[model samples]
Target: MAKKGHSEEQILRALRQAEGGTRVADICREHGISEATYYIWKKKYSGLGLSELRELRQLREENSKLKHLVADLSLDRHILQEIVQNKAVRPRHRRELGRWTQAVFALSTRRVSGLMMLNRATMNYQSRRDPQHALRTRMRELAASRVRFGYRRLTVMLRREGWKVNAKRIYRLYTEDGLAVRTKVRKKIARRARVPALRATRPNERWSMDFVAARLIDGRWFRVLTVVDQFTRECVLLLADSSLTGQKVASALSQVIAERGAPMSITVDNGIEFASKAMDAWAYQYGVQLNFIRPGRPVENGYIESFNGRLRDECLNVEVFFALIDVRDKLERWRRDYNQVRPHGALSDSAPAVFAAQWTDTAVPGPEPVPDRTGKPAAGNSLEILT
Candidate 1:
């Protein structure tokens, strides 16, 4: 019906009239078209409507564009893959590229930069940064004095001294100055699958113990035995001494057990004092299971380890202990507050002592009941005497 190259929608609409029983010759004559063309359209798209024919044409065009885009990407990937093979530019490659740029003086700067895949400004500009000579000198002084300190430690010390510099920048300059910390190679140990230990659902069900060390004001080193309840997160005991053997540790636990009752299980590391015969005998006597963590692994007993870190940070690090009596007094006060005052998130924002007391209160019955009054009319009724 329409001229050639017009939308298929127009032709399909005209053909619909012919399909309604109008003579083909008359339809073609009225629509200014030939019978041969009409027949070609009917053979190809007799069952299709105008919308379907238009959609089919759009899909063909989109498919053609997608194919061309995929081909272009493949060509680009191949070209980049062979770049290294074309030239084995190694040491002094930047210098070589610079010379090539100068040799092509007749060419435009943009054209030469495009060929090299570099920016014109990068090729022309020179850095004006001041080499931090003073900072490097100070870092060397600290590193030399403390041979065991690494770059990260040096960064901390620098911050303490009011120097503002980042670790990345210091590390680059440290390497350029040939200042590297010596590191020890650790031997790899074979590991075996281990059964996971059960978590305690209530206080006294499980307890974790670990040791912490600190120096007194007079530089005398002392150790503290830290025992914590896994369920309540309460510090049950703190034993401090200049020297604590397996027997002494066991003795301390016995006294605490005698007062508060024995735990169902005790979690500990594979330290000599914990794995000794003294501890084993105590465990057997009390009928308490001794759960030992894997060799060289402390995360299995994470509760006591976290508690020990907090003790070191909050008490051991801040106070300067002058005597063993002083240590006892300070640690006892802190432990009391830790259990009764400090709120533990794991215990629903209540203190460990408070949480444990709640369970005990629920378990035990309340005070004696009061006597019941029966066989009486309600209150405020007065009976009349004989008149």
Candidate 2:
């Protein structure tokens, strides 16, 4: 007789009796099993009950059905292959079979000295005979003429020049010719002088101010005082001041505060106007942290530096400024457009407005505290600026 294994129902019944204080020896005798077998069953099925046994039975039936299905599939596959091989199928089916046979024969051959074999030499010769080398050369030259051009754009330019080539093929050649340029890696500079790291997560959390010098079209010299939002890349203030002193900067900052409220910190380079006691006192009075970039490192304040370049190129470069009002109007218009519509490729081609709009109040931890001038509790959302 074949050795009997414990059925799920039998194991569960034994476990139920064992849990009810039935002795293992008696339970084993009643089940007609040895003590070792009883222990093994207890270990395997002690926690299982009637519901679990029923589920196991269902799973076993499913597994048997799946096995039968797989066997039937294998048999059916063989029958289908036979039908496809038969001459009774469509002419297209026979043609496909013939192509497959040819491909297999070509792949299996060693082709010693090539007695008419489809080999690497034949493939290379066909590629050379395709008459697209001239078109490919033109595409490469066009891509080089532009500072940088992707294959799709190159394909467009080629088509405009009457090349009639596919964009996919151009892309293949573009990558194959090693034309891809890797993006420049940005490194975070470390603070060595024990200065506290300025934390700003929202617009106006921190402001950075700097002076950029440029000559008017008449060759008269002046300075551009630019104040930028450290978080949102917004230009908070801009002025075409002829002679900027510490008092002037403080006065401008005060005006900005009256308009847009005070920022938590102001980062600046070590210019004399920025380092003055008057500017420092004004910043301190408003409870604003003053930060200075490292000496001689212009890139330390890179955001403002980049902003200045764009301001010059887009606005200042296009006009002649005879008066401060003219400069002011152009600067204001450019700043508005820059913040609202100009796309920043560095920020994934998002405009500053779109980028700022994504920042929910939940993203910021809390507003900084500021005191009211009257020493009384201010209304909601107005921070108290402590001296």
Candidate number achieving the greatest lDDT relative to the actual structure: 1
| Pairs of residues clashing in candidate 2 | 370-383, 370-384, 370-385, 371-384, 371-385
Task: Please list the residue runs of candidate 1 whose C-alpha ends up more than 4 Å from where it truly belongs after superposition.
Answer: 1-196, 364-387
The digit string of per-residue lDDT tens for model 2 on 1-387 reads 101565666777788898899998899899898888877766655676778766866786789899999986775455446445654343433434434443644422233112222343332332334646776677668766642446655665676568767878887677657776444477887856654455555667787789988776677788989998877787888878778899998998889887777776788999999999999888777767788889997766777898887777557766678777777787888788778765565655456766766763325333754465534332223322232
Stretches of candidate 2 exceeding 4 Å from the true structure: 1-199, 360-387
Task: Name the weakest run of 10 consecutive residues (lDDT summed) in model 2.
Answer: 108-117
Evaluated at residue 128, the lDDT of candidate 2 is 30
Consecutive 10-residue window with the lowest summed lDDT within model 1: 377-386
List, residue by residue over 48-160, the lDDT tens digit for candidate 1: 87787778667877888899989866754554454444462442344345445456444455654565575677656565878889999999998776554567666766775
Model 1: per-residue Cα lDDT at residue 345: 56
